[model samples]
Target: MRATFHLKTLTVAIAAFSVASAASAAGLDRSGQDVTAFLQDGLYAEAVYTYIDGDVSGHDNAYIGPDKKAYEQGKKIDDIAESYDFFRYGVKADINDTFSVGILYDEPFGAAADYSGDNNFVARGDLDASVNAISGGKASSAADAGLKIGQLTAGATQAGAAAANFAAQAQTATTPQAAAGFAEQAQAAQTQAQTLAGQAQSLGAAVAAARAEAATTGEGTNVEVRTESVTGILGMKLGENKNFQVYGGPVMQQVQADVALRGIAYGPATGYTTHISSDQDYGWLAGVSYSKPEIALLAALTYRSEIDHSLNIDETYPLVAALGGDPVQGNKIDITTPKSVNFDFQTGVNQTTLATAKVRWVPWTDFAIVPPLYNEVSKRSTGDDKGLPLVSYDEDQWLVELGLAKRLSPALAVTGTVGWDSGAGDPVTSLGPIEGYYSAGLGAKYNLTENWAVSAGGKYLWFGDAQGQIPTKTIVSDFDSNDGYALGVKVSYQAK
Candidate 1:
């Protein structure tokens, strides 16, 4: 009975840790590369599904321009993230005591959000000429100030024509008093023309300045990221007791994303949307594992290399072309996903209990997405020759999880976990608002038969307070008093 309980606790902790560990990681981390599932002893297969629900709300939020002033005020941006689901599957087989192979399918990274709500932050621009921006320009809320500026020019032209006609009548006057009156009228009309011309020049300058400033202000965005990957693994056992194993293989990944921007703060990005897709990107993973059956100790360290992709991207923004900006833009971009390292270990504390811990590091600071044309416009407008990224990370991330598992019966096991993430940076982009999280989880595993078992787990995450910033490093929004949770279930089967 004692041995059976220890085995049950260890097995259940390994099975449930995948979902619990991922619930607190950084960036679009979904599966946490749960290679442990692929390292099972024999012919093993498992499928797991996870659902995450998050709610974010904040106040006193506004987009600050490069001039260090509020460019626009925003209402509460709430319910930005809806519920999302993820699925993972893996199968492993042991050809012999010293050889094993496996394959896994999972979504390693992803992000989703819908900004359609009562706030104008994410809504399409009306391009109203009556609206004024903080930078002092007509139609400042609109990306294309050309239409309004054109109207002003046309009105000035009409005034100039009338003034010329009055001067001609003055030259043909029959009486000195009438001629003097006509000349005065022509002079007033000419003065008015000069005034209008001056106004037009000032308007043009103001509009240009506003456009430049707007490029540096943050805006509301709707972004979705989808990733699918297949990893093939081969493992070899070594040492006299076959206690050490090494594994590595090829990985193929597919990535896609759709991003849309809006709000007065976005300027040229307003009504801009793009679709990016990649079919195949190759990478590799290598790992070493050590196991001691007597003490129920298993330790593994894995490294996943970054994958580079040249992707086809479709860009669209009607206002951009209308405003003399490029709408039909570059078709391809080179992007690379960040690399990561994972170290996981578990040990038997006693006959009935086990302890587990995992630590993950991802060099997110090395990650960035910069569309070509967008970068060009940003460079010209912000006077930053290097340009800015559409999305990026300022710092690396670390996630740590510790847990304990115990078996109450031969068929039932329970585990509890606490997790923490270091977050990629402070004042992250509005696209991914939360900085980091602290999480707690509980899980239970039940065996229906000798070869079949199921486990369910739930985790609650407390998000850290964070501010959203633009390229100018001005605060545009605040995210706080936010929380989220995830629920997952896994079913596993072993061939007898």
Candidate 2:
């Protein structure tokens, strides 16, 4: 039974992640570019354009009992958003022969949102009954036991006082029948107290047993979840030699998030959505790069600071209206995306060959979502404080990329890359699309003249499947997804 409740909770977390995906895909990591250095020294007074497409899907299953009488069937949720574009135009100005500075404006963060309202959806009766039975049974048992114990103690004290009064009356009364009647009443009161006391003990024991069973059941199910983040960046560079440059600037970010049970449904139907939206947040990044133009070796190191945000989350449950379920309102949640360190290295193997590698580390262990806020909101809406349990998460990841670029001629070059990323799985929140990736692309530079050039390229990415464990049940499902494709064009004119 505990496993059943946990499965429901896992479903909630996964649903939250799905809703947040749109926001995360658009934020600071927009277009999967990581192209900061690519835009450096080579261009002055130039325009660059880009486009991307993406597709994602998943299924959920929830069980309510061992007999399979109470269960919710799995369902599919698909998403497709494309034609999203990013643009930038900037100039690189050389100062003297040893210094230069460039300013750029680009759309760094954005995403599209869509979820089907019907089809392949199921909300089982046993599922809702199981959830209510466990949660309600526990609460009801506790309240009943408390009230019964209080009443029993009060009755025992009253009976003892009445016995003393009857003893006093016995000494002064002339009629034996009257004294006997008082004794009989006192005995009846004592009997009632004992019965109530016994009932309270039984209820207390049942509550403890039910709670213990729930705890044991919670550890079996697996869950898949995601978060949302959108960011825009404007960067400026200062340095000389084009080989050594320092860049720093402000980043604008927006986030949206939600949580729901993966395989569970709310009312007489399948799943409902519950989540929160964060207000816009502001943050910054600083980095330095070094290139050996004479040797063909280029390396860059950067630090992206963490952003703290307060999200306004709403709780929705269809069962509440149909089955008179508990009322819940929207509340605020505080969350923070971790800081990161990135290293990129590229070298020219020959006049026609260039190789590049990159590594990025994010401190995911430092973040978590607090569930008490949900309880506060629930209480305010329902006049009861039966709060939802909190969920814990942490993630650490490593990424490696290898690419080769060959110059077809003085005015054109083609490049292709393959990468590997291994990190935490779907069970852990904050585990973005970095799961596993395979990619390849080609690019070209056209020299319009000795001082002017134009470049264009396109790439397709294929991402591997991401899966998570449901807390207590052996039930597992796929959080399957596909790759994204992007196209880019750039024009640059150098100063003599």
Candidate 3:
């Protein structure tokens, strides 16, 4: 006989995972954009909360910018990954056996990071007094170094002239004793001059390097993005047994962001900043589903279209302004969120066990953020009149997860899962420098009453190694062996 008893645990586990699989996802994916709630047999509603934290740290590149030797020691970078959290709500109601209506809410896409500590990513003060102004650990403050170097060079020149005068006197000496005394004085003066000259050369190089460091790094690199979405779906049952269904709905989304680019990592693009005001946009989603309740089988495929937004922005690029580029104001930036696909499936393994699989894909390469003034100023350096976007990716993203759920008792259930996410790409943007991750998770659900259930879950992620780069694709940092975790809780109600 087909298994039916394991359905409750499987359903709860899937819902909980939809919330846990965020933050560490490739690109800016969050909440998994799940729609399974609408596939339930009757009335259902759920509220979920998830929190995530990642330990992302690495070393700065030694060979970035004209001061290639400044960071030879590759200073340590402090943890840049900031903790993130969000909420999701879903509600669904079946009208007869052939019609269903549902609404879902989630914070679907976002990013957060901050650069701190002694790394080049942080802004330095004047080369003489700034902490970020370092050159092979030997550079001093600008005032101190320049003064000392000046004194050494001047002293060396004086000593050289004195040596020449002494040698000339020796050449004209009338007595052997006088000639010996003059030659000895000449030798001592020449030795002093040579020693000072060598010292000046070494110190001069160090001070120049410090100055270069100060010029290339002006602010810490950081980014924060937030978005909220609400989707309304209406599903129709097909087939005589109503085992198949098709559904779609409109999606409303609001988004905002703040970004700053800094450090030798960004080269001439350092000291760039942008603020995108919150803007609301619309899109659509459609999907198909099949179910066999007797065997606890369900399969669904969903597609969400990209939303286009024209948002007001504020921007500043010191490099551009210094070069006499026109100031930009009251401009609208056009951004199109990436589209995505999610396929989810589950089937009963026995009377008390169920197996599940989820797969997701996003075309991250097609998405980018291009600030107008930044692009325009870039033409002076590069002949490409089209310029370049301030931020973009080189590859698409894919994620897969597999798991099993077991009903331990009539009112209790447990689940476990393993997942993999293909990050946007290696050598990713310095703001979010990770190549993707592998994850393991566990969840438990307990029915408080016949119609009320509470569930909790947690996931541990092992992040992949990657090189952090600037928009121009110059490698400036390295991150490896980083990790993170996620925790989630959900309260749900359903009536059949």
Task: List, residue by residue over 1-496, the lDDT tens digit for candidate 2.
Answer: 1111221111111101000111123112442224342334443566667766766455543433333123344555444233466566555555544555555454433334333322122222232233433332322444654565567667766766766676677566678888777777766766665655554443443343333333323221112233333333333444555467666566555666554431232111123345656577767777777866543566888777787878787765433343334535566777675666777776656555666676766554565555443444334323455643233333554556566666666555555655555443444221132244455665566566766666776666665665423222123233465677667777666644
Residue runs of model 1 more than 4 Å from their true location after superposition: 1-15, 63-74, 124-131, 134-220, 322-325
Write one digit per residue (lDDT tens) for candidate 3, span 1-496: 4336446545543435555756545778777787877777789998889999999999988652344323343889988999988999999999888999999999889999999877768766455543223332333455666677798899999999999999999999999999999999999999999989866654564454344446655457899999999999999999998999999999999999999876545544556688999999999999999998767899999999999999998987655443455444447899899999999998888777778899999999999988887777666445588887877888899999988877778778788889999999987888888988999998888888878888888999999888887666667788988999999998989998
Task: For residue 385, give model 2's deviation from the true position in Å.
Answer: 12
- Model 1 residue 148 CA deviation (Å) reads 12
Error of 3 at 465 (Å): 0.6
Write down the lDDT of every candidate, Cα atoms only: 0.73, 0.47, 0.79
lDDT of 3 at 33: 83
Give the C-alpha lDDT of model 2.
0.47
